[model samples]
Target: ALHLEMTGFLVVKPEGYVEEAAAGEEGTVYAEADYKTQVATNVQTQEVIDSVVVYITGRNYQDFPEVVALVEDATDQLTFAEDAKAKAEAAAGTGDWQNATLWAGQWWQYQVKAADIGLRAKTFLDEHGAVETAQ
Candidate 1:
């Protein structure tokens, strides 16, 4: 997924220098090039699908404040969830069922939170998907 998106990804900006010809008699026209932008973002999965891109495109706009906020909130929740899951896994792996139970309980709650966040993001993106454009 990232590979396909990357093919279209682009970073266009004014660059390159114009060389002086004959001491300012005429500025040499330097070479110039430009490219388009394509964005695909995703985290790899071990399951059947090897790649994926998780992002919500905005309608005729790139600076999506609402999307940013949503992402921030979700990220925070996911971070906590990841940490909890790691702790619980470590405890269980070490045969510490006593603490594992406690941490596992917290891990379960965080897992729910993360799932909810995922749902919220999906819903928002689906409702506000950008008008698809070819570059």
Candidate 2:
């Protein structure tokens, strides 16, 4: 088995009984509680191990797509903020104070949106367990 870096996240509970080993699978076939020592040669036991493996390595292993989308939204908003800043600079260069102020307001709005989106994404990831909490 590959080393699971985060043991805190994946908690396994094993409740089982000893069974006779089948032919050929005399070695440890499946042992939930004492996986390193006990040998199992039963289909039911193998299924349990398979389920545990899948549970540990399935959805919890990857980032949520919505979280990634939120980050992309934040990045796009930041890009717009930069563009707004450029427009504000150009308006100021032409001595259009009103237009410059309007552009500056737009830039601020974009910045706020970006910040909100980024924060929301982080919160979502933290709540979903994709981002590990500090021990």
Candidate 3:
């Protein structure tokens, strides 16, 4: 039996600068920040989905010397699903589900695992100077 659901994912790129009008200044100074947004959805239903955005801005950007390092760290921590998939495939090699439930659980575990990973990654990023400006 196949349990089907609509699914999709998105990655948002950050805008480089923000514009503001100073009280007495003639022009705007560079805000100096980066941002990204991500979203996921069920393809069949087309319903609104929960999502997260990671951003680095303001004085925080100045404090963090390696912004990309933070991003890479976050990405590195999110391989749980990939690992789960590999384990599932290996277990299915014997053509059995009884002993494979642990590995086969990957399908159900994906979303939860991914979400947890995202949250943790976001936390790590924030601690290192990445800000969550919006969802």
TM-score of each: 0.46, 0.49, 0.31
What ranking emerges by lDDT with the best candidate at the front? 2, 1, 3
Summed backbone clashes in each candidate are 1, 0, 4
TM-score of 2: 0.49
Q: By TM-score, how accurate is candidate 1? A: 0.46
> After TM-score superposition, what is the CA distance of residue 126 in candidate 1 from its true location, in Å?
2.1
The Cα error of candidate 3 at residue 60, in Å, is: 10
Worst 10 residues of 2 by lDDT: 33-42
Per-residue lDDT over 31-96 for candidate 3, one digit per residue giving the tens place of the 0 to 100 score: 111000011121111121134322333224434446445434434434554565456556556644
Write down the TM-score for model 3: 0.31
Stretches of candidate 2 exceeding 4 Å from the true structure: 1-62, 132-135
lDDT of 2 by residue, 1-135 (tens): 124435565544457855678776444222222321211222233354344333423333236788667667766887897798788768767766566666666776776676666556656655778634232
Q: Candidate 1, 88: how far from true, in Å?
A: 1.0
lDDT of 2: 0.56
lDDT, residue 43, candidate 1: 15
**Global CA lDDT of candidate 3, please?**
0.41
lDDT of 1 by residue, 6-108 (tens): 7877544447856567754643322111000000110111111111013333232244566556656656766775676677558667766555555555655
